[model samples]
Target: MEKKFNKVVLAYSGGLDTSIIIAWLKETYGCEVIAVSANVGQADELEGLEAKALATGASKYIELDLRKEFVEDFIFPAIKANAKYEGKYLLGTSLARPIIGKKLVEVAKAEGADAICHGCTGKGNDQVRFELAIKAFAPDMPIIAPWRVWDIKSRDDEIDYAEARKIPLKINRETNYSKDKNLWHLSHEGLDLENPANEPKYDEILELGVSPEKAPDTPTYVTITFEKGIPVALDGEKMDGVTLIEKLNKIGGANGIGIIDMVENRLVGMKSRGVYETPGGTILYQAHQDLEEITVDKYTAHFKQKVSLELADILYNGYWYSPLTEAINAFVDKTQENVNGDVKLKLYKGNIIEAGMTSPTSLYSEQTASFGEDDDYNQADSAGFINLYGLPIKMIAKAKEGSL
Candidate 1:
């Protein structure tokens, strides 16, 4: 007798692993499988996913549009904090999984699934990301991961199994590198990138960003408007979150703005090299940081940038479900209370330069700031203020003199 599962919901992407797991789950557990995919700006990657899931023996398939929520809820919050991992990475893939996982639980409950299955390999950060979300929402639900439980050890083995079973392989077998793409960014990993000596092939590795050499000669002047820390307009045109990103992407891509290549440490304990294209995200991040510089106070602004690094680590390491992340987000929200303004940026080739910023809450007064013509500052007032501020230095000097 087969160990029974009445129904299972899988976070299906219609990728190699997910495609294979759909058939395996039916064979192993003898259960009805429901495939659910979250559309977090994956573009055409999601095309034919529903038909493919049904072809692989799924009882039903559900695809929900989450691009707006992904931007407003997850991406905007991170942008408000200016979260970037390792001072270079933008955490594009990091913050996307939680939204995907949260959707999995909701679908599973509606479908009456006895368990939730995921296509994530045991060694990667996604397995932890997916499972933690399942645990948080449905603690008692049985979790199944095929890579951990099954005997398949390599991609070749998986392909062999797929071929014999007649499941059409979507990815070309000869293409060694794996790529993940979405509206926010696209990432390339494995194969030639695994070697540090090899420079990435420009022709095969890009989608959004243009080659620097191919970029137009003129610098692009762009303006972004934000309200209460969320981006609302691009280049003076008031647009929704989705439309705004798409427009900026066109401009940034033409100018080669957001292209990143680096070797980063994976949460699973390995050094991996990857190339990323974040055209729209790069522009938005630059605009957000520029706004913060003018709107936020000195102490809060500096400290929030520091907090951003920690936030990047958590999001990248799949710790989005922890208490620390909640606390950090609360702190970030408080800091963003004044992060509302318009930022003018000069975009040239691959650079994002801050031109100027104007905010109603700006502490910058021309009379106080300008040395050429400033009536607000009394020159005599500085003498007493400096003396009071330097008192500790004087005390330390006196103490040293007495000891000597």
Candidate 2:
């Protein structure tokens, strides 16, 4: 017995899984399959995707150019929140999912489709990210996740099925690394990365840039300008969010600015090893932090650190549109109001060194912190302040001395 629907809009990537998914959707459910690809700066990945979808039996294929929107909408907000999963991973793949899922919902509604489909597997966090976004946008829309329902068990099994159906694929058995690329980052999982003991073969697997060992000996200098915590310019050239990120990717990659390998706790209660390349993103994060140090007050900066942890967890767990995320973003936006500044960074063989930072809203005062200041201070005033501040320690020391 075949389950039937009028139409289903699939969040397609033209990758191995989705290429096979389009045919499976048509054969298993007898529904019209519409493939939608959102271009979020995945340079070569979008090539021939439309024709590929159609050849794979999709009734229609729609590719949306979402690079600018992805950066200004999703990327900037995460930057403002300073969101990082487990303190190293930049949440690159995690951040892209919501925008892609949101676009799928829009396409499904416009096409008058009753269902939305994805190629995410049962064990992965992406399934939660995609389905949650779908449920958020269109609660009644049916979600047809082939990995969860179908009998296909592994990538080898999927490859065999694709071969049997005569579907063309970019991936084969030897290409072991599963990758996801967007403007912000490129992520690699599977293959040797499945084992924690196995070191990532960076020389072979890296797509965006060379490893630090292979980077040039000469250091590179770059200046980044931010307004309200969003990066607006790089190296004194003003550009849009997408352009700035793209330019930095090239500059940072040349100098080996960002590369991370970590074993992270997945949302599904399992550990997964992933290698992420975030060349431009790493520079931006370092620059933003430097600017914030001068512009943000101590208390607010401390409090925002706590908020950043919550924001990172929400993003990694795929709650981008939830009320809690909205609230935290609202708070983050308020903090960025004063975070306007320019930061100069020295990129050298995978190290982001803070060269300098300046802000009109900077809370630092040379006169107040100077050692030889003559005005507005009494040298004896520190004695009273120290006594009050250390009263508890002083009392504890006296009690111990008396007992001895």
Give the number of the best model, judged by TM-score.
2
lDDT per residue as tens, model 1, 65-129: 99998888888888888999888888878878888888888888887888898888877778888
Q: What is the lDDT of residue 382 in candidate 2?
A: 93
What C-alpha lDDT values do all the predictions have? Answer: 0.85, 0.91
Counted clashes in each candidate structure: 0, 0
Candidate 2 has a TM-score of: 0.97
- TM-scores of all models? 0.93, 0.97
Report the lDDT of model 1 for residue 197: 93
Cα RMSD (angstroms) for every candidate in the order listed: 2.1, 1.4
Question: Model 2 misses residue 138 by how many Å?
Answer: 0.5
Off by over 4 Å in 2: 399-404
* Model 1 global lDDT (CA atoms, 0 to 1): 0.85
